[model samples]
Target: MNIVDLLPAILAVIVGLVVLVWSADKFVDGAVGVAKFCGMSTLLIGMVIVGFGTSAPEMVVSALSAVQGNPQLALGNAYGSNIANIALILGVTALISPILVQRSVLKKDLPLLIGVTVLSILLLLDGDVSRLDGVVFLAVFFGVMGFNIWKEKKSANKATEPAEAGELAEVSESAEKPMSLGKSIFWLVLGMGLLVASSRALVWGAVDIAHSLGVSDLLIGLTIVAIGTSLPELASSIAAARKGEDDLAVGNIIGSNLFNTLMVVGIAASISPMNQIDGEVLYRDMPLMGILTLSLLVLGFRRKGDGRINRVAGIVLLLVYVAYLTILGLKTTGVL
Candidate 1:
């Protein structure tokens, strides 16, 4: 390829990275600020709103790809993103600091994550993700959210113990500072718009770059597009780690994965049924994602009290990711 022909792809990557990073910061600040403005508690905001915001990139990419009739790309993006979020994003974040897993997250959100993941896979067993499947997933998503809200309320009402009362007091204090509802809505919408626009540019650029390099769409979606869309999670988790906000890092990753599986693929399939899982994804990608999730769970269990994801775990995750990419390349080249 001519040097000049590479400019658009190169520029696309640079612009995509810039927008993704900017959007992540803006989305985090705006969502958290809006949550505080509402009567929502901090943990609720972190678990739901911030989690959803961190996943904006995957949702946009998958929905757009599905709309554009590249359903395989959509599925690959969602699956690859989940793997990247846990193995790449969380792994790197933990390497920065020993992320402390909150009891609530461990007992509540983690199970939900695992359940949703398995549920999604089961839904796809028919070889396609239909609109009906999307509806089921969305229903489950809302049910989980509702259960969380109920739990929060119940916890607040039954704060008889000193520790429980103290927790309730903190929740009440945080909810006291309400901002104008209209202003909060405005920021939420604006941040979402930026996220959508940037994701489109990123995906288009990524696709163009892949085509220019004579790479198959599947390979591009699995690697470049996947990593690009995961940029938000990486940036946010890293910042959270550096700030010693371990919950934020862990929460962001888990939240992103949940949203990617439920919202991203759910919405995409709702638009139009996604194609069957490609042979490569079925044989390689899905297994890799499962392995990564299981590995993270093991690490979390092993270091339960220590609250540390050491460099060794980080290295292992990185090595796994590298091996995954190598296998993908081999398959693409017909060498495997």
Candidate 2:
């Protein structure tokens, strides 16, 4: 592609990434503010609203790509975002400060994330994601979410322990106070609108860049688009870590990865079935995703020192991410 042809796509990517991050922040802020105003418990707001809001970019981009007849882009975006969320975002967050794992996360969220990751990989093992498979994934997604909400409700009722109270205090202390109802609603709507627009621009740029360079859309989605869409998580996690909200930072990654692996992919496949899954996706990307998820689960189990991910572990995860990117780069350069 000539410079004239390349410039627009590159510009779209740059602009889209910026807007997507901005909109995601706005969406989370508005949703959190409104949820708190509505008298929702801090646990529920943290568990449900923030989780879904962070994954919004992946959902929108994948849906748009699937509708536009680019299932590769859709699938890649979901799975790639999953990979990046854990490997890249968590790695960076841990490097900033060792992330302390909550017992709830280790026992509940991490296991569910692993199960979902494995389930997604198994579905793609056959080289296609049929509508039936999509339905199955969606069924599991909703079932898991329903059970989680129930469990959280139970915990909310039964828990008034000192540690629990302390955690709740931290959450409440960090949460912003309510604004006028009208302003909250406005930000919610505007954020959703901007998210959709930015996702469209991102997918278009990624697909165009893929085509122009004779690279697979899957690769483009896996690398550029995935990282772009995940910027919000990276930003949020780092900020949370800096504030010493280690549980919040780690929980954000777990929740976002779960949503990406299940809900985002399920919605995309149900919208437009991916009839031909890429071989590399099964052999390459999915394995890496599984490895990262498993690594997090193992590291999170508190054998010593409050089950935290230290700087050494952070560096290791970062190196793994860099190695994955290097492999993709080589593939693009005809060296792999």
Candidate 3:
């Protein structure tokens, strides 16, 4: 492609990346600010809203791709995002500082993540994810989310500490400020609009970049697009790790993966049925995802007192991700 023809694609990538990061930050800040204002517990906000916010990029990209009638691309974005969230995002975050797993996450969220993964695979058994499958997935998503909220309410009631109640009351009072709900809604809408536009731009730019570079769309989707969309997860996890909120880092990654499977892929397939798994997805991508999930499970099981993912495990995860990318590159070039 000539330089002039390449201009829009190049600019699209740059602009999309910038917009994705900015929009994610705005979305998170606004959501957390509002939640704190409402006197929500940190555990509740972290489990639901923050987790959902971090995965927003993947959801938007997948939904847009599905709406654009590219089910394969949408499916790739979902599965690829899961892989990146686990291997690259968690790996990088743990490298910053080993993440600790919270008991609630281990007992509740992690199993739910595994169940969603297995359910996703089962739904694809017919070689297509029909609209009905999407409904089923979403039903499960809502059910899980509702259950978590209920659990949080129960936990809060049982929390008898005066200091804890005071802290929550203070947070709620801050949330009770006079800021217009309309303004908050506007920010939310604006951020979502930017995310949708940028996702489309990134997908289009990625397709062009792949063709120009003689790379397969699958490879592009797995590497560049996947990592770009996963930027929010990487950043959030690392920040949480630096603050020694290891549970948040681990929970964020786990929650993102769960959302990608249940919400992102579910919505995408609901809009347009995704066809059978592509050769790359079956041979390389799905296996890679399964491997990473298995690794996380093993790590969790081997946890010492604090259930931390150690530096050695972090290095191993990062190496596995790099090796997977290398394999994808080789397959794209017909060398595998």
Candidate 4:
């Protein structure tokens, strides 16, 4: 109940995050290396491999939270990560370098994100994320994944066409040269081991902190846990932006959000259905996520050749995120 009691839990979170980010990078590197060997498209590698790899934290954390009988933390971690992906991750990345992208590439993803955001809200309205609801999400997740694979294959085929042959550069152009498959699998196993261990430490500490602070697990998840798990996406996105791989940077955000919304929540809820819905999730969190998603959608719809989210927009997004955090702080301190 005191600061002294919170120390170990705090330390767990700190150490857990440090290891979590490091391991996720290793995981993605290994995964991407293998994908490159299979000759996957550059954009596909960014969206699926890096996006899903970085999102493994949320999946692991949420699944553990649910299995350990903390479904609120699981649900909060999923939705909260979505909020952070847009307002926090994208906002910070844009500040480092304004996001520039071809709207054609974004055509399928942004709209699909909006659709799923709305669908998630509708599912929440019944006051619970039921097992059946989780099934629906999982089915949709697999469907999206199937589409991504097909789309990637289609892109490869289209790129071979004489008219589009200009885009037929190397598949690994966005990333460094590929490593050997044996080495890739070695790091994959190592990273996955560390990733699960770190996730368990994080979940345990976060739940303990919530109990000690007399706050809901949902609150802890939405704030500390959400931000911590999202760190990999932030790091990768910034690195991609600085490297001028704008599509890769943007795809990582968009894809990560999709993974958080569907895979993270679906796995958790399927493991243990969230029959008790938190009010803040529907009233406060989902609405904020919806708004941020819509704003990002609007920012991408420029008729100009390349839609650019410039510095000013980045500042505004950051301000909105800060305002949301301020509200959480006031609520925690009983001042709201």
Candidate 5:
């Protein structure tokens, strides 16, 4: 492709990623600020509110794509985001700081994540996610949400004084800044607007680049669009990690994956059945997703390592992701 045609797409991706990251930070801050003002528990805010915010892009995009009859794009976006959440997002976050898994996350969240991944694969094995399948997914998603609420309550009751004090300290810190309700709400709206805008720009640029390179839309959705949409998770996770909020960093990834698997796909399929999904989804992408989930399960439960993903592990994850992308590129270019 000529430089004149290629340059704008490249610039769009760069600018989109930058803006997405900034907007996510603002979004999280405003959310946290408002939640604290309302006297919500830190655990609840982190677990439920922020988690949903980060996955909003995938949900919206998938829903619209499904309605537009581009089921592959919808399906690819969800599955591809899950893959990106684990391999690309977590890998990069761990590289920035070794992620220490919370005991609660290891015990409950990790296992649920694996189970959900397997469930998603089973649904897709028949080569379509029908409305019935979507109903099942939504059932599981709501079940998981209820379980999370129960877990949070139990944790709250059992929380030690030190942990409670730490949470309060965080709340107090936010209180010190004292964001006015109007400003907090303003940031929330503005951040969401910018998020959608940036996501569109990123997707448009990625699609343009893919078309110019003769890459199929499915592959484009899986690679460029997937990564573009996942920028929010990557940014939020890395920001949390740098601040030593280890649990939040890891939790964000887990929550986003669950949302992608259950909510995004479920809503999309229920709106308009996704039929005749590419065979690669079954034989290739689904297996890769399952394997990555299994790998995370094993890596996250290391008795010797205290559930830590070190830089070495990070590099390994990144390499696996790179290899997966390379294979996709080869296949898209008819080299495979």
Candidate 6:
């Protein structure tokens, strides 16, 4: 790769990442505002609104990759972003502040996430995610969404307090006025528009970089593309953790991972037959991702009280993520 070729791709990546972060911030705010305005519960806001908002980049990027005849890139981005969400994003969030798991989250969300992870692995074991598989994924995802909505509505009168949820719920019930419906919708539309555009730019740059480096699209997606698309989750989760909205912070990670696991992969496989998914997805990425998903249950397990992921645990998660990237780099470059 000449300097000329490298420079533009690098520039595109940097600029694309910057815009993605900013737009994602606006998107989350707008989504939260809209959810509150519509009377959604805080957990629902964290999972549905914030989760969908942050996971938008992964969804768009994967869909575009599939449409462009890059199924490997699509799978890599979807599953890679899943690994990043749990290991990188959550690791950093917990490093900044210990994350507390709510009873509702442990009982409802965590087990579901584990089940989803297992399902993903089983689908990939067939060496491809078929159209039927895609349909199944979307069905399960939507069903889970419906169930969460029903549960939240059923417990509307006994909603979680702000102390457990942190600034997320507090802000909704705060004396400070919230954004108007029109304004929130405007930001939501604007953010979604920008996300689509920036994701295209990012995909272009990623393809170029992959070609230049003489690596597969999967490699690029698993690293640069994955991390870039995941910046939103990292940003939002950290902000939530700092404010002591432990459930919101943790919920964001869980929600984003779930979306990537189901919606992103499902959309990609549905649009483009992923019959030749790389072996690495099944043997390497998916296994590690499943283990990490299970680790959440172990880390959040409580003997007598609420579960907490502390700084020591945070350091361990961070180290695991760092090692993961290192191994990916080594393998991509034929060093492993």
Steric clash pairs (candidate 4) = none
Rank by TM-score, descending?
A: 5, 6, 4, 1, 3, 2
Best model number under TM-score: 5
What is the C-alpha local distance difference test score of candidate 1? Answer: 0.71
Quote each prediction's TM-score: 0.76, 0.75, 0.75, 0.77, 0.81, 0.78
lDDT per residue (tens digit) for residues 20-117 in model 4: 76776666566556666665654566678677877887888888998998877877777778788888888898998998867766577778888988
Q: Alpha carbon lDDT of residue 147, candidate 2?
A: 86
- lDDT against the true structure, per candidate, is 0.71, 0.75, 0.72, 0.78, 0.78, 0.79
| TM-score winner between candidates 4 and 6 | 6
lDDT of 6 by residue, 196-254 (tens): 56766776787797888797775765566667676667766776677566666787788
Candidate 5 lDDT: 0.78
Q: Please provide, for model 3 over 35-101, each residue's C-alpha lDDT reduced to its tens digit, 9 standing for 90 to 100.
A: 4455455445555665787677677777888889986777777887888888888888777787776
How well is each residue in 79-156 modelled by candidate 2, as lDDT tens digits?
A: 777788888988988888888887667776788888888888888888999888888988998898788777766765
Ordered list by lDDT, greatest first: 6, 5, 4, 2, 3, 1
* lDDT for 1 (candidate 6): 65
Lowest lDDT sum, 10 consecutive residues, model 6, at 156-165
Question: What residue runs in model 4 are displaced by over 4 Å at the alpha carbon?
Answer: 1-39, 161-225
Candidate 5, residue 87: how far the Cα is off, in Å: 0.7
The TM-score of predicted model 3 comes to 0.75
- What lDDT score goes with residue 296 in model 3? 77
Which scores higher on TM-score, 2 or 4? 4
* Model 3 pairs in collision: 37-175
TM-score, candidate 6, is: 0.78
Q: How high is the lDDT of residue 51 in model 2?
A: 64
